[model samples]
Every structure is written in C-alpha cells, then in structure tokens.
Target: MNKNTFLGITGLISCFFFSGIALLQAQSKSADLKNWPKGSSPKEIGTRVADHFVVTPHTNFGKPTPPKVITYPESCTWYGALTFAKASGNKKLTRDLAERFEPLFGVESKMIPVPDHVDYCVFGAVPLELYLQTNDKKYLDLGISIAEKQWGPPEGPRVKEESHEFYKQGYTWQTRLWIDDMYMITALQAQAFRATGNQKYIDRAAKEMVFYLDQLQKPNGLFYHAPDVPFYWGRGDGWMAAGMTELLSSMPKNNPNRERIMKGYTDMMASLLKYQGKNGMWNQLIDDPEAWAETSATGMFTFAMITGVKKGWLDKEIYGKAARNGWLGLVSYINENSEVTEVCEGTNKKNDRQYYLDRKRNTGDLHGQAPILWCATALLR
Candidate 1:
C-alpha cells in the first residue's frame, strides 16, 4: 500500500479506537453507577447539581426564579448542595451557596409564626447550617427565629391530634399531618436541636414523628400520603424516610422517643425493601407495579437506606446491597448536564390514584435534583 494510504488507515483506526473508548466510558459511567472510579463520585455528582444552579443562578423552574426569592424545592436543593459541599470539604463552595439565600433568612415574617404553611418553612435549616459553620449572629438569630415560629405558641391554638384531617380541612400548620410535613418541619427542628443544644426542639421533632406514625403508618409499615390519600406517594414516603433519618442523626441517643423513632424508621426501611424495582429504582406509586420508575424518590430512598445502614439502624448485609442498587438506579436518571430526569413535579394530596399517575415529570426540577445531591452526600457519610 502507498505510504499516504497506510498513514490514513492508521489514523482512522486510532480515531475509531479512541471514540469507542469514550463511548464505553460514558456507558460505564451511566451503567456502573453504584461503583466509584469507573463511575461518578458522590462529590462529582453533587458538584454538578450545585453547579447547575450556580451557573444559571436564576432557574425558571422555580416559582420566583431564584436570586429573587427561594422556594421550597429550591431551598431543599440548596441545603443538599450545602451539605455536600461541607462533606466534600469545599469550604468556599459551601459559603458561597449559603450566602445566596441570606436575604431570605433575615425576613421576619418568613420565619415568624411559621409562615402559615409548612412549605414556606422548609428552608429554615439553611440559616442554621450557615450559622453552625460561620457562627454569625445574624444566621443564628434567623435559625432561632424560624425554630421559635415552628415551635408555635406557648399556649395558644395549637394544632391538635383531632385536627388531623385530609384536604386541608381546617388543617393548620401544626395539625396537618401530610407525609411531606415530616421533611418540611422535622428536618428544621432536628437542625434546631443540633445547633442550639435545645431539648425542646428535639422533643418537638420526635413527638411529631410519634404522632404521624400513629396517624399514618399502615400495617405494611409504609405511610399513607395523607388521611384522605390512601396511595403511598413516592416522594411523600421519601420525605418521611429522609426526615426520620435526619432527625435520628441529631436526636439525643438517650431521649425517651428515640426507640420509637428508630422503629418507625427501620420499619419504613423494611417496607421499602419490598418495593425497590429490579433496576434499583422505586416507582412513582411505590406499591404499584405499573408506575414508571422515579428518580427523586429513588434518590431519597437511597439516601435514607444508606443512612440507615451506615448508622446501624438497618442491617448492612441486607440493606447495603439495596442502597447500592438504589444509588445505581438513581444515577441513571441524571443526564450529561447533571440534570436529574423523571422527577415528579410538586404535587398535592389527591383522592384518585390516576392523579399521581398523571403527574408530570421534569428534568432539573429541584424536587428531583435535591434528592440526588442529598443521596450523594449520604453515600459519602
């Protein structure tokens, strides 16, 4: 063969070989997600989630569109990013992200009286996180303010057990016992207890878990989404599972309610073991076989189960495999841009099963990405 032809053939062969390797790498990254090195590291995955908002700074996916105001899911994602940053030892990254929500921290009405809705109270822990790291009085005051509000009145109209009704039927912030409330309020109170060394905050969170467990936990060990909603919504259970783990992490080991909380958490984990799909994912309707596999719930469950195994709350020999598989399942939904896909949009309690089945799934939604970040951080922990 001619010299030029020989050289051309050699170059073509090299290009194909390199291209094939790249393709395999990409495939392996997506496929072998449970494994590290060949797969993405937790920090790497979390950084992508953080960078998505960091670069954009104003995601239209949010209600007020970021930098202007923080919303529930956005705040959740931000806190997860902060946690991951702290865990990964990226001090500057943590501080920079925490500052983005500083303005929201100082607003009195937002933190006081519990803001009338638990959703608004979701980000209360962010200020506490910043306060813990920086020890700035402003963040500390903000956290305390939020905690005080959430603790409700000293002796006024408190949400009682009788008020636990579905569909917001006279359900006050304290009384409404949706599964989402676990994450929204419990995590904040847990952080409050941790930040302040206050037993009241811990008691409030643990007691609420006791109340909800009585009201909602089924014989199957899973929780109903709400009183009126019988279906086990994936994210709702995710909230319950993740919230309990967060509370368990901070709750005093000697507290009276500790064993009760632990049982609820472990029982929930047992239920989750039965529902995990063959692909390492859970469905939108967790008990439903036909429902599509969901990414956000998968991430939340992964975080919860892994936390359980690590803390010895769950059997590592059994749940460790599930956690690993769950992580592998979740990473598949995270695309090349670090955008998490198949995340169920923000949902409300519905009496019908199809309502949940019909919920739209979106990419890069904070509801989806936050869990991924949280799961990544948990894996590291």
Candidate 2:
C-alpha cells in the first residue's frame, strides 16, 4: 500500500477501537448504576425504598385511630409512597394509596381528637398535597375539613383538651404545638391557600408555626421537641427540618414570613451541628453524646442540612461533610432490602437522654423510610 493509504487506515482502526471501548464503559456504568453510592439520585433512592418496603398491601393504612381507625403514621407512609410513586413513575400505586384515605373522611366521630399535634398536621397535609398533584377535590376537601377541625382558631385550642400524657401537666393551656407539627401540616396549609385563594389557611399555618417557635426554641438556638420539653430530640428535630424544607418549598418567594422561616432553619441547623456525632449521626437526644446514634433522625437531619445548602440558606462547604457523614452512618444501617434499622420508635419524649436511648428501634416503618427518602432526595439534589 502507498504511505498515505497506510497512515489513513491506521487512524481509522484506532478510532474504531476507542469508540468500542467507550461503548463498553457506558454499558457497564448503566448496569452497575444501582450499586452507585446511595446519594446518587432521588429517583434511584426512591426506587430502592419502593422496592424494599412497599411489599405489603395497604401497609400505609394502619389500624385507624379515634372516630376512624386510620392513623397518621399510615398517612406519613402514604406520603412517602406517593413521593416514591411519582419519582419512580408508579402511577398505579400512587392512585391506589391516594384512594385509601378517602374513607378517613367518612368517619362519623373524631377518634383520637387532639387537633394541634403533629399527627393531625402530617395526616391532613399529605392528603392535601396528593390532592393537589392529582387535582382530586376529594383529598383537598378532606384535608381542609381536618385542618379546620384540628387547627383551633388562632386565639384558641385546636384540640378540645390537652389530655395526652405528654401535655397533661405542661404549663401551656393552648393546643400543644410540637416541632413535628410544622412538618405535618404547614405545606398542606400552603397548598390549601393556593388552591382556594383563602388566606385563612396560610394565616393559620403562620400562627401555629409562630406558636411552636415561641414555645419550643431553647436559648442555645436548638428547639425542644415540645414547649414544656427541655432536651432536643433528634427525630423531632428531623420532623421540623423536613417540615421547614417542604413548607419553604411551597411558600411564595415574597411571603413576609420567608426570611423569618429561613433564619429559624439556619439557627436550628447551627445548633444541631454542635451535637452531631463523630460518625455523622445525631444521638437520640441530640445535645448529648452519651445517647445512642439514631438513624431516622440522622436521615432527616441530613435531608434538612443538604436541602438548606441547596436553597442557599446554609453553607454547603461547612455543612456538606456533616450531611455526608450522616448518610454514611445511615447507610450502614440500611439492609439489602432497603429496610432501615436502628430507628427509634415512637415516643412522646421529654428532655431526658435516658428516654431517648431507651426508645426501641423499629424496622421498615414509615418513620424511618420517610426520612431516608428525604435524605436520599436531598443528597441526590
């Protein structure tokens, strides 16, 4: 062959070889994507969550609470499921789960009727969001009715009585507002306001949030789980952390309370950092290291801190390491099936370290999974 022809043939062969290698690498990456770090993408993490925990039929709807048997944990589960459904494109699960709550509205009497609690807020709020997403007026109406009944007038009590064991002796007479209440209902209220053009929902949300802030903030910038409580609970903090992100996400950019909410979030995060475990997890009792490292709260905190960074409310350089560590620690506890272990079970906690450490860890529950999803979503973003 001539010299020019020989050179041209060699270049073509090299190009073809390189292209083949690139194609192989691309296929390998796609096949191994699931093995990527847990924080890779919201869709992936969400898919893992759905695949592992969503095995049972209507696991989201637990035994109902008062006038109705349906409880808030179920609602929270459904919320997570709904988010997972949307993220994973599982339209059928989304539709089925959303419809299950319709019967909750049919209960003739209020079964566990303490309106100002986090349960009321979360239960009412998730359905409201689902309603908005589906444009289903039923969910919206049900959410509104529950909010109106449970959220007492700004000047009064949302619940008729603060008879719950946690509030039986607290000095406050008004409906007890916990940090989790913000997570439970604020976004729903915002949705209600937007859907109906009614200012009452927004006003009510702001009023209750202010009540929570006024009553729960400690001098150190961390908030106590409840007004009468002294110690900061990690999961409670998580609830508030997630709540702040969701509420702010839905809030109007120019809303007067926007800056205040952001400041509150910043302060909370700063205080939380002081207590973060060396392993990146927060102890059950956030302020105390003697307490055991808890995964659910850590997951929620990770979500909140990362989200705060994304929103420009927090410095990612300073907080990113902490969030990453928390996620790593959290991952150690996630089983192959996506079941999260070492999550503290439900507790109406007081400001006591012993109480936090003593709480049992439950697997495969929404409390753990929701925060895990939040953490994954935050990290992915």
lDDT of each: 0.78, 0.66
- Residue 306 error, candidate 2, Å: 2.3
lDDT of 2 by residue, 183-268 (tens): 76665566677667787777666655655766776667677777667777888888777777776765667777777777777788
Q: After superposition, which runs of candidate 1 have C-alpha atoms over 4 Å from their true positions? A: 1-37, 58-69, 103-114, 154-173
Note the residue pairs that clash in candidate 1: none
Candidate 2: give its CA RMSD in angstroms: 10.0
Best by TM-score: 1
Each model's RMSD to truth, in Å?
A: 6.0, 10.0
